[model samples]
Target chain A: MFDWLQHFADWLIFTVFNIDAGTKLGTALNFFVYDTIKIMILLFVIVFIMGIVNTYFPIEQLKNYLNKKKLYGLEYVFSAIFGAITPFCSCSSVPLFIGFVQGGIPLGVTFSFLITSPLVNEVAIAMFLGMFGLKATLIYAFSGILLGTIGGWLLGKMNLEPLLSDWVKEILKLKMQQTSYQKEQQTFYQRLPEITRAATDIVKGVLLYVIIGIAIGAIMHGYVPENFFNQYLGGGQWWTVPLAVILAVPMYANAAGIVPVIQVFVAKGVPLGTAIAFMMATVGLSIPEATLLKKVMSLKLITLFFAVVTICIIISGYVFNLLL
Target chain B: MSKVIKVLGTGCPKCKAMTQVVTDVISKHNIDATVEKVEDIIEIMKYNVMTTPALLVDDTICIKGRVPSQDEVFTFLSNNE
Candidate 1:
C-alpha cells in the first residue's frame, strides 16, 4: 500500500542524494524519510476521521448513561474501550477525571478510562500500525485494554474512597447535577472546517516529537548492532521488564513520539513486552499526571494509584512475553 | 446588559488561546461584558464541565471542549446581550 512512499524515499536517498544504498547514512536516511512520511499520512487520516466521528458522538449522553447504569464488571471494559477511542490529552486529565467521578461513575471504572486513554488512542494506534504491522498493533491494543480493566477493577476493590481530598469530598456531598450543554447540530460540510482545523492542530502539536522519535529510530535502525539490546534487555530476564517500567516512569512523552523509539527497541534485540511496558509506563504513569491528580486525590491515593498501575504494567509485560 | 464571561481552563495553551479569542471579541464589539479566566480546578468543577476552555456567559455554558471562532464568540455575546 505504501510502496510509493518507500520508492520515493529510495529515489530521494540513492538517486537524488547520490548516496550508496548500502552505506549507514544512506540506510538511515531512507528509513527516516519513509517512516516519517508513512506515519504522518496515517496520523492525519486517522485524526481527521476521528474528529468527524467526535463531532457527532454524544459524549454527554454516554457519560449520563454510564452514570445511571450498573454494567456489572463490564463497566471496566466499557470504560477501557471509551478510553481507547477518545483522543485525550494529558492536559485535560484533571477535568476529565473530576467529571467522571462527579458524574457518579465508580472510582475504579473512572480509573479504567484514565489508564487506557493515554496508553491506546488514535495517535498510538496509527504509529503502531505503521511501525509494527497489524498483528502487533492488535496485541498491543488488547493488552492495553486488559491492563486498564484489571488494574481499575483491583483499585476499585481497595475501598479507597476515604483517600479523596476534602475538596472532592465536599463536592461529592453536594452531588452537583451534570450540566447538559446544548450543542448546535450542523451538517458534515458545515462542520468540516472546524474538524479540519482540529485535525491540523493535533498534527502540528505532535510533529516535533514525532520527528525526534523517528530520527532516533533511524539512527538505531542503521547504526546500532543488531544484538546490542538483546545482549542486555533480552533473554527473558524478569528484572528487565520491571526495570524498563521503572526507567520509563520518570520520562514522559506522548504515544506519537514514543512509539517510534519503541519500534526501534523491538527491531533491535529488546523483548517486545519490555518495550511495550516501557512505553506504557512512560505514557500512562507520569509525574505531571500525578501532580494533576493531587487536586482531587490525597498524597496517599496518588502514591497508591501509581504503585498499583506500575505493578499492573510490569505484570502485563511478563504476560505478553509469555504468550507472544 | 453588562455580563460576566468566565473562561474555564487549566491553563493549557488551548485554554490561553480561548481566553485570547474571547478577550479580542469582547474588545472588538465593545460589548458590556467582563471576562474572567478561571484556572482553578475546584472552581471549574463547580460548573460541572469536563472539558477545558469552556466559555460560560453569565454562568451558562455556551461552549466547551474547544475554542470558539471569533464569529461564534460574537454570536454568543450578541445573543446573550
Candidate 2:
C-alpha cells in the first residue's frame, strides 16, 4: 500500500541527496522521511472521520440509557466500549468523570471508561495499523477493552466510595436526577467545517511528537544492532513486562509519539508484549492525569486507581507475549 | 433583558476557544448577552452536559462538544431572543 512512499524515500535519499543507501545516515533519513509523512496522512484521515462520528454520536442519549439500565455486570464492558469511542481530551476527564458518577453510574463502570478512553482510540488504532499490522492492532484494541473492564470491576469491588473527596461525596449524597439536553439536528454539510477544523487541530497537536518519535525510530533502525535488544528484552522473561510498565509509568506521551519507538523496539528483538506494555503505560498513566484525578479523589483512591491500572497493564503485556 | 450566555467547560483549549468566540461575537455583533465561563465541575454537571465547550443561551444549550465559529455564535444568540 505504501510502496510509492518507499520509492519516494529511496529516490529522495539516494538520488536527490546523492548518498549511499547502504550507509547508516542514508537508511535512517529515509526511514524518518517515509514514516513521518505516512503517519501524518493516516492521522489526519482517521481523526477527520472520528470528528464527524463524534458530532453525530448521541452521547447524551447513550448516557441517559446507561443511567436507566441495570446492566448487571455488563456496565463495565459498556463503559469501556463507550470510552473507546468518545474522543475526549484527558484535560477534560475530571468533569466527564464527575458527570458520569453524578448520573448514578457505578464508580467501577466510570473507572472502566476512564481506563480505556486514552489507551484505545481511533488515532491509536490508525497508527498501529500503519506501523504494525491488522493483527497487532486487533490484539491491542481487545486488550485495552479487557484491561478497562477487569481493572474497573476490581476497583468497584473494593468499596472505595469513602475515598472520594468531600466535594464529590456531597454531590453523591444529593442523588440529583440526571438532566437530559435536546439534541440538535444538523445536516452533514452544516457540520463539515467544524469537523475539518477539529481534524486539523488534532494533526497540528501531534505533528511534533510524530517527528521526534520517527527520528528516534530512524536512528535506532539504522545504527542499533538487530540483536542489541534481544539480550535484555527479547525473551519472555517474567520480569520484563512489569519492568516495562513501571519504567513507562513516570513518562507520558501520546500514542503517536510512542508507537514509532515501539515499532523500532519490536524490530530490534524486543518482545511484542513488553513493547506494548511500555506503550500503554506511557500513554495511559501519567503524573498530570494523576494530579487531575486528585481534585475528586483522596490520595488513597488515586493511588489505588493507578496501582490497579498498572497491574492490569502488566498482565496485558504478558498476555500479548503469550498469545503473539 | 440581557440574554444569559453560559459557556460550560473545564478550561480545555476548546473550551477556552469557545469562550473566546462567544465573547468576540457579543462584542463584534453587539449582542446583549453576558458571557460566563462555567469552569467548576459541580456547576458544569448541573447542566447535564457530557462534553465541555457547551454553549448555553438563557440555559438553553446551543452547542456542545465542539467550538462554534463567530457567525454560528451570532446566529445562536440572535435566534435565542
Question: What are the per-residue Cα lDDT tens digits for candidate 1 across A18-39?
Answer: 9999999999999999999999
Model 2 TM-score on a 0 to 1 scale: 0.94
lDDT at A206, model 2: 80
Quote the lDDT for A245 in model 2: 86
CAPRI accuracy category, model 1: medium
DockQ of 1: 0.59
Q: Write the per-residue lDDT of candidate 2 for residues A165-260, one digit (tens) a residue.
A: 998888777867544454576678877888898889888988888888889999999999987889977885689888888888765855677889
**Native contacts recovered, each model:** 0.51, 0.40
DockQ scores of the candidates: 0.59, 0.55
What lDDT does candidate 1 reach at residue A233? 85
Q: TM-score of chain A for candidate 1?
A: 0.94
Fill in the DockQ of model 2.
0.55
